[model samples]
Target: MLKTALGRYINNFKGFTHEVWILALITFINRAGTMVLPFLSKYLKEDLQFTYGEVGWIMVSFGLGSMLGSWLGGKLSDKIGFYKIMIFSLFTSGILFILLQFVTTFWGLCFAMFIIMAISDMFRPAMFVSLSVYAKPENRVRALSLVRLAVNLGFTAGPALGGLIIIGMGYQGLFWVDGITCMIAISIFAFYIKEKKKTSINKDNIVLSDLPKSIYKDKPFWLLLFISFVTFMVFLQIFSTLPLYHNEKFGLSEFQTGMLLSINGLLVFLLEMPIVSTLERKGVNKIKNIAYGCFFIAAGYFILLFDSWVGILVISIVLLTFGEIFSFPFVNAVALSRAPKGQEGQYMGFYTMSFSLAHIVSSKTGLEIIAHYNYQINWLIMGTLGLLALLCCFWLNELVHTKKKS
Candidate 1:
């Protein structure tokens, strides 16, 4: 019975083209090498002796750059091509990461963070569109999930590897690894992955005119964006504030903290694709799935309110992992599939920007709250935000159904 189930699970991954697999592999290498971000907050606070507020501001710089990059990547992918942007973003950012270790001052670091992130995050929206170019209509959702799996798989390795690197070479080692990985990841793509011409393909099967062409005017899409923002905000906190919480409240070492964080990635790596495939096959409502995901995420934060036992930490992360697995792939599918064929880059670019915006809010607000209030208070606030996102999803669902009937 177990073997049958395992075989069934593996079956969901089979249909993707070689290009999709290559894209997934590229995403994995790039993301796996992303060791610096998971520990950036701790590095800033502990190694550089920066205050929480300072860290918040630097992250703001990082996020603003990410926002700018997302917009540019989308725009450029439309105007030039995703291929050029991907090459430039990774290669430039790789050089920047190595050089960033030199700047220890507050303002200098802030400027550096913003510039590097702007270049790096350009890779995101471009990559999202690349999947559209590479994947077939039938295989698109799983293709997106494959990339997410790569991300989580990379993340699964990143925190654990990062922890060891920190121990051996201190935080400086993370910078070098991060930088080298970016270049290596891009080099593989540059050498082997030729740029494919964008074709007039419609993955959603619905008429393009049925959906709003302008992202700004699409009310349902706005709600989806808000839902995505809340999800990213909550998830980003684990990397930003939660590490500090583990150190101060739980008295866990960097290695122990990495292990705890790696659990989230490991669970996602193992579960997300199968879960995503199952839901798609069952013809589940994407909005409803996202709403439930919101509840799980909120509960993850709410559980943090009971931090007496170390076991609660493990349980909370489990819930958060479920929340992530449910919402993210569907969100990408809905956005990417609905996009007008010629303007996919704009739609996905803006979609990814929501995440970057959430990163800004997540990092700065989380740090500020941690600095001013206690961890419980911060957790309480985050949980409330998750609930708000849940309510919004419900509203969006009703509106979408109402429109369909009209």
Candidate 2:
């Protein structure tokens, strides 16, 4: 009977539109490569014997490249096409992954990571563009939710697999596996996925700048982007610093760290949408949700300042994950709704820049904090930043509400 219920659930998922499924598959594969990142600091520090400063520099290199890529990728897609941009991004990032096998020096790894991040980020703007083209307006939220599910599922398996590979073969072997999987993903996309084309009549009616400029003028629109930057700063810490903290502070093994990260993703996979619905039903504005998320995030890390047991560590992560789901989707939904009638692609491109900025800041900031102070001190500081973010959200709520009433 339980098997029958699970089967029904699986079938329901499969019944989504073909475009949504295609995007989901592509997202899954891309995210599989991405999941290795959560453990990268550990691999670098342990296997390569790199200093915290060097590790921080490497991440900053990638962030710098990604920032440029995010802005250009959107405009490029507008000039070329989303399908072509996606293919380019996949193959280019795959090659960079394969090249990681040769890097031993700090500068070499930085160069390779920067190239990989820049090219891979080219896909970011295009994904939203293609999704807008494919999904009906009414079905877009569900379509995006399914794609996010694929990301979580992919990470669930990928990081665990990455941990095993690192345990058995070391970091080089993990990079090789990532490169191979990415190549397979590219081939699958090229051979099996169909591109959804915009009708010429529809294209003829719209000017390229019309949509982008309109979105820029909306005050709430830019405020949403700023909040995204802050959220990413908080989120990136999970990937870039937390693993290092676990290794140094708690003396966690690679496998154990992988399990902890997996727990964070698992809760999102299971409960994100339900929580979003609950908050929305309670008449919570997006700003309020973002504010509450920030507060909880701060509190969770503060809780960690005192935690010594693995079990308590797990609880802190659970608290952090709840904040993540609330802030992430709520921010995206608010931005998407505020986008001009036909400018989702442009707005999403602008939106992605926030991530680029956050990555840059977190990579550099996290490393500096660890080097100058200590891991515990760094955590405390980030907790403080979370409070600042909460305050920003309240200011944002007032701004958005006033704009609406006007």
Candidate 3:
């Protein structure tokens, strides 16, 4: 009976096509080399002696670039398709990383960082489009979960390895390694994966008047988008403020901080796919699952309020990981489900822009809060925001349900 259970568990991973696996592999390779951005705030403060305000602005530049990139990538993918955009994004962004290593001045660094983030982020919408195109509708969420699994697995390795690289070779080594891995991902895509051919639509049957309305005009989607932006604003603090918080409050080293960050990835790697699959099999509602995720995220932040102990930190991360597992992949699935036929890229792009928008506000505002007050207040604010986001999720659920009934 135990062996039969084990076999069933193993079989849960078996149904995706070769292209989906390739996409997962590419995600793995790129994310494994994700060394620079996670460490950028630390590098700027520790190495370059930048002030907190300056670091905030630098991150703002990155956010602006990310927002613009998502918009442009979505628009361009709709026009030219995902393949060309993916290839260009990977190759050019890799080269920009190599160039970024040489930039010393603050403005120069900002300019380079902006371009690098913009180019690198273009991959998001293209990848989302590719996932929808390659996977069957029934399997798309599971396919995306596989990709997320690869991402977390790679993330599990990247920061730990990056810590060692930082100790041995300094910050420049991070850029070189990241650039090389991006090229490796690019090669995998160019050689192994052929873009899915667009199915031809008959012009006679296609009513120009019946084309999907612009995303701006879609009220429900916009509401969902707003909720996404708010949730991400809370969620993204893990990247922006949490690192600095760890350093300041707990006096953690770079390696220690990296390990702390990796805990979230480790938990997700171990649990997310199985949980999501099991939940789906049990016929759990995705929207309710997401609401639960929001609550857990808030709980994670709330936990941080009591102490700076290592044990508490670990528990906080665990809660946050559960939140991520429940929320992120399902959110993507919902966004894809809502998109009109032939407009996947545009919808995905807008979906991605929500996170980019969060980056802009989360980092800068988080730092400003920390600069003025304390980490406790920051956590409190984020936890409160998470509760607000939970309410938004419930509203979104009703909105979607109403639309379907209509």
lDDT of 3 by residue, 195-276 (tens): 7765555567755554447767777778778877888899888888888888888888878878987888888877888888
Give all candidates' CA lDDT scores.
Answer: 0.89, 0.76, 0.86
Alpha carbon lDDT at 78, candidate 1:
89
- Backbone clashes in model 2, listed as residue pairs: none
TM-score of each model, in listed order = 0.97, 0.89, 0.95
**Mind giving the per-residue lDDT tens digits that candidate 1 earns over 30-89?**
888898888999999999999889999999999999999999999999889999999999
| Cα RMSD (angstroms) for every candidate in the order listed | 1.6, 3.4, 2.2
Cα deviation in Å at residue 190, candidate 1?
1.9
| Candidate 3 colliding pairs | none
Top lDDT model? 1
- Give the lowest summed-lDDT range of ten residues in model 1: 200-209
Model 2: per-residue Cα lDDT over 1-406, one tens digit each: 9999566445435435677778889788877776568877777777789988888888888788887777778778766778888888888788788787788899988887877888888888888777777776655655666777778777877787778888788778777777777777778888877766643436566565434456657776787787778777876788888887777778888888888888877887777655654555576777788887888788777877785675767877888887887777677667666665445556777888789889889978988988888777877887888888888888888986775576
